[model samples]
Target: MDFDLTPPTEEMEKFRQEVRTWLEENIAEEMKESLDADEFTEEKYWYWREKHKELARKGWLNPTYPKEYGGGGLTGAHEAVIVQEMRRARACPNLSNRRPPETIMVWGTEEQKQKFLAPLLTAQMTCWQKLTEPSSGSDLASYQSTAVRDGDDWVLNGSNVFISGRGPGPAGGPDYLFGPMLTDPQAPRHRNLGYFAIPVRGPGVEIRSMNLIVGRDSHFVFLNDVRVPGDHLIGGDHQGWQVLSTQLEQEHGGDGGGGQALAPDQSVENLITYARQTKINGRSLGSDPLVEQSTEEAYIDSHIDKLFSKRAYWIHESGSQLAHEGGLSHLSDKVCGIRNANRVRDVMGPYGLLGIKDHLAPHGGTQEIQLRRAIALSHLAGSLNIAKVVLARRMGISRTQERAAPMRTSGAKAAH
Candidate 1:
């Protein structure tokens, strides 16, 4: 087993140069400056959206996706180069809500794919994953949101909290919202649900922003008797658990082989810079052996996290059976994030806690935001304990061996 990454071929190298040149010439300075902003503003949101549309037009947004669906229809290596160059330019567009489109590609009918997936893949619209409800966060099977069958539509009624999406103002909300809804009250746990795609601007769909310690653009979504066309229901009625498993697998880091290297965590890099620049007793703080050692540890931990993700990505691209790999990547990211946060605080003390509002905040207050994220990440995708349990189950270290969830790939692979 060679642990080294295969070097890019000549064709790949040429493609990389092409991507780098395109990004350098096209990415606006405003967009580059926005990357350092403390929070994503309404102006910044639209700026990024325009950039997303630009990439979509070039078919680079979903490069590995089939060309017929408005993707570049490129290979995984090509996609990796696009991702790498985009990150190198610090102009990567936000395409985080990928679960819906990927799920649709797997279980949807032809009409559904054309209707839902094309817009999503092409960046014609945005989407939000309404998974966590007011009553259930981790235990998704216990979701109380109900979708009752109507003549030719499904009437959804429930509230979801901490829902994430792009855009800021009411006019800037996502074009679609998707998640599991209880369909059969009398049925078994996994069989009682239906997955749906609800239009955010449609009647009875309401969104209210939630204020948090950190400035994350999260919201509370209220669906009151929201009517969704029957065709919008995916994977057939009562088979939502199966469709959801695909999305959850990706979300939990099971689908790490998305043909791109994980982007380096900016916060870690900024922390290192802070340690090297800040003065202590007329010498750089990083010059102190203790502070230097701690900073290096943080860097090492972040690198390890990226490696776990890379391995998972490689396994998926190789078409090998991917069990426990995604879990390992997800678990490593969460744990390493916590560890790095502690290291930052230990070295920088109170300065690490300063927000963007503070005049003295370092790196545009990203360190402060990272510390908050470290606290919130444990509960966001899945808790650290939940990640551990899932990894154990996937690795067959439990009472009963649990198989990894099935994932269906579309022409253009969804980004994690």
Candidate 2:
């Protein structure tokens, strides 16, 4: 658990103790025991949702956001304590993180925050973002969804594919979902859009499942004249680009939560352990020099990802100008995911996936599952290409700023 990282200071130590004590007192004993079980079951998922709800009510989930929006109103330091404790317990974090709520808080009006965000922070509701279209994955700004104003309401019409939490799941259902659409198709590129909060169960909305090899519950959604209230508009009309930027920042960026700024790479560590124990060809798999080399590479890559992401989060929390750091951090994660999954699979050979649903396979054949996910993730979250472009643009901006500074100095001298 130590991982030989920086030691906790007095305040951090106290806070760590506080979180540990709170979990012990608040979490159900049976729930804790079930979480520790090897076999994942329906009960495990159900209890995980219950745990999420409990964390939401306690405001620990959105710790760094404003309390008015149902957040914990804690600083980045406080959030780090919560994350450390969760990891200390060896809990696998649910994918439903604080991003959805954080995005709304960034761009929503006071009324919108009251209507939508308050419910989210307290687990009274959940939300899904409709950004990725059937064809638009990396080119997210070129989404085909459209929203036409109809009296005081707006009519939304478009389709989205591969939506993560579309219909039903263990966490129940989402109350509403955010949609970004073209308000004026005739208007220029980024200026002709709008963002709206549409009801999931509302009329004119259609959703279908997208069956992936990893058994994820993603969906394809269609909106046909779905009416959104006037107040549902976020970031004002035709200002969707601004809202989108903020949303993506929160999605890809991490506000420093002390040391809990990034996800741990447990999969690699687990893979290494499996190889050390499992025998292949009458010898331990780890005995192979190639497998040992690949495992070491993966282990190092995992740690590097955490370090890169942590620095980016610190930049965000410090309110400094974010320099391609968010995009680069995210890019590293997705790329590492792809490389590690492939390398580990190759090292495990057929044993990693041979008996996927039977014995003899390592980690219950979850590596096979991870391989499928890694393939999908590589294409998701802005794609590796888009992330690269983001970083490049930041570099261009830096150069532009440098040039403008000298010109401004010359102009000041002339005025004098």
Candidate 3:
């Protein structure tokens, strides 16, 4: 594998300085404190909104998007500088969160772009992927959240589980849902889906929080008779499934699951610290060859994950279409993250399950917290099996695209 990374040009450096300056000023102290404390209270949610708006207004949030709709209209290289700066500041969200707006720009109507995509540029709204169902385990086609046509409106009914929407970040950006638009209960399996946005705060929309390990939480949203206008639909009627497939492929190809990138990656560092503090026969735990080996493996996997993600980001950001890179990166990230967590647990043994208040818990019990999160990550965003399927299809070893195409087209034809 090529280990070389492209160096930023002088222009990028100037942009970097400009970005750093803006972040230094606009990133609030309280928001920073919240991140340090890993707190996501309602107050912190409001802060996420403000921060997103500022970043949007400054054209930093949508750096690679067309400037006409609140983006900076930049290239991959430009976004890299912005990302580098944001990573250094420990502000912003995962690269995945940054993708929905781009998808809106691509598949949404011009008006939709203006109303919804524009805010993404300016951080005026926060969007979550409300795709998972109580019964569907990492299967988008199996989504049972039905949106039936009612006069000029679409009345939605059903519940989505495992939505990873934190309280609007530290900004007051109201939450929205990017999920399946097709809801015909009798439709064929893969065809009964299209993607669209639904205002999560609308009437009949009830979101109950589900706590993860530590202070983190996911959401369970119930869309009970929540009505959305036909205008909110993305792509042609029943064209949603196809559009959604394209979006996922593009997301994997381009961003490698890059969302808002709000949090820093401190899992490996915390594990290392824990190992150093631990004692086996009064010697540093890290001194033990087995422990050292485990830590080294984690360090390597984490490094590979970052590099793989960067490569995928570079491919997508450079205006290239990714066939396998996105899936590869995503698969690697999940594998590496889960693997690293297990390794840490092995290193810590019983103490890895300790709570933050426990004296035996190292790094405020981050290892234990990570174990919980790691387990969730297995199936949360996308399961390993799902990633592998995507990768295999992208690599032409699987005929899912062919199977899916026929199903998607049949659904569209049925709608007509």
Candidate 4:
């Protein structure tokens, strides 16, 4: 197998230059300064929101999405160029919560797509996936959130804890939320659910910020008799498990057929820089064999994680059959993140624990945030143990027949 990096074509190079020029002319200095911030202020929030809208208007935000739905209608290579330029400028907008639009694209009726996907694609709305519940951690199929049909609407009543989104602050909360709900309790486990999207400001929907060790970005969302229009349901009733599996596949590191760019962990690089500059007995800390070894190990592990994601990206871009690759990428990210964080702490000593408020904190306390996030994210998406089980299932090691989750490509023909 050839492993050499292919140079971009001349036309692609020109497009890259165009994107670079646009960002240089448009991205504000204030946004660049706050790019590494752990939390967003009200002002920063609006700044990001407006900038995202600007990109959306230009079809650069979700470049590969269908043009009819407000995307750029570009190819995967074009999307890759946009992502590369955005990352280089350090102004990549956090337009996450992609599952809603993707699921809608694959399963929504024409009216549903026009109402929901259009706003999402245009950056007029932001969404959060309400999957995790107070009772169900990584066991998503066992969620207790229930949705009962009432005439032309669905009444949902349940609570989701540890929901990751920007809580109500200067910029306000998410515009919508989408996730699976128990539609048929008597049905079998995988066939008992239904997926729906509801506006966050709708009646009986409440969001409360949670005080966590790392940051306050997480929230507890409560839905009490929340009435959602029946048209909001995607993939039909009691077919949520199939629809949600597509989303889970993407969340667990599958590419969803979009050209994905690798965003390397800055903490590892920061630690290496610190070790080189730091002095111990008038000698560079990196000169110590133990410190050097730990730093090298961390860098190597992070590089491997990046490679895994790059491979997954290539697989999806090529439309090759994807199995166990996403699981491998996610598992490496979770395991290597914690391992690298420990290595950073071991190499930097107490300085690694300093927060952004500390005057002596290195790299604006980005390393500290990374260290905490490593621990927090281990339990997010899916726990490391659960990730292992998923990998085993995908690899066909846990069962005679491999249980590969179906992955639906957004904007592409429906796979179901």
Q: Give the C-alpha lDDT of model 2.
A: 0.68
In model 4, where do residues sit more than 4 Å from their true spots?
Answer: 1-9, 33-38, 167-171, 256-261, 400-402, 410-416
How much lDDT does candidate 3 score? Answer: 0.67
lDDT of 2 by residue, 1-416 (tens): 34423357898788778778878777665545321123445565566666767786777776766677677777666676777677766553533444556556666767777998888777667777778898877777787799999999999999997777623443333567786899988888878888888887878887776777645457778889899888888876887866666566655533432345444666797788977987888998888898888898898887787777777666665556665666667778788889999887888777766535667767766677677778877766577776666656655753332111111001112110
TM-score of each: 0.90, 0.83, 0.83, 0.91
Clashes of 1: 5
Go through the candidates in order and give the C-alpha RMSD of each one to the true structure.
3.5, 6.4, 4.8, 2.7
Candidate 1 local lDDT, residue 222: 90
Between candidates 2 and 4, the lDDT winner: 4
Per-residue alpha-carbon lDDT of model 4 for 1-416, expressed as tens digits? 23213357998899989989999999887666352444566676777777888898888998867789988887677777887678778784655576667777777788888999888888888888889898887888897999999999999999988877753372257889999999999998988999989788878988888777657778888999999988878877888988888788777777732444344457787888999999979999999999989998988888777778778877765656788888898898889989999998898778888887898988877788888888987877889998898888888888544544554342254443
Which pairs of residues have clashing backbones in candidate 1?
64-412, 65-411, 65-412, 66-411, 257-313
Candidate 1 lDDT tens digits, 1-416: 23225367898788888878888998776666443333556776777777888888887888866677767777655766777678788774554486777687777777888998888888887898989998788899997899999999899999988887656674457989889999999999999998898998878988987766645467888989999889989877888988888788877886673644445567788888898889878999999899999999988888878788888776655556677889999898789888999998898889888877788878867788788888887667888988888899988898766765665542333222
RMSD of model 2 against the true structure: 6.4
* TM-score of model 4 vs. true structure: 0.91
When summed lDDT is taken over every stretch of 10 residues in candidate 4, the lowest stretch is 407-416
Off by over 4 Å in 1: 1-10, 33-38, 170-172, 257-261, 410-416
Cα misplacement distance, residue 306 of candidate 2 (Å): 1.4
lDDT of 1 at 84: 69
- Cα-based lDDT at residue 229, candidate 4: 83
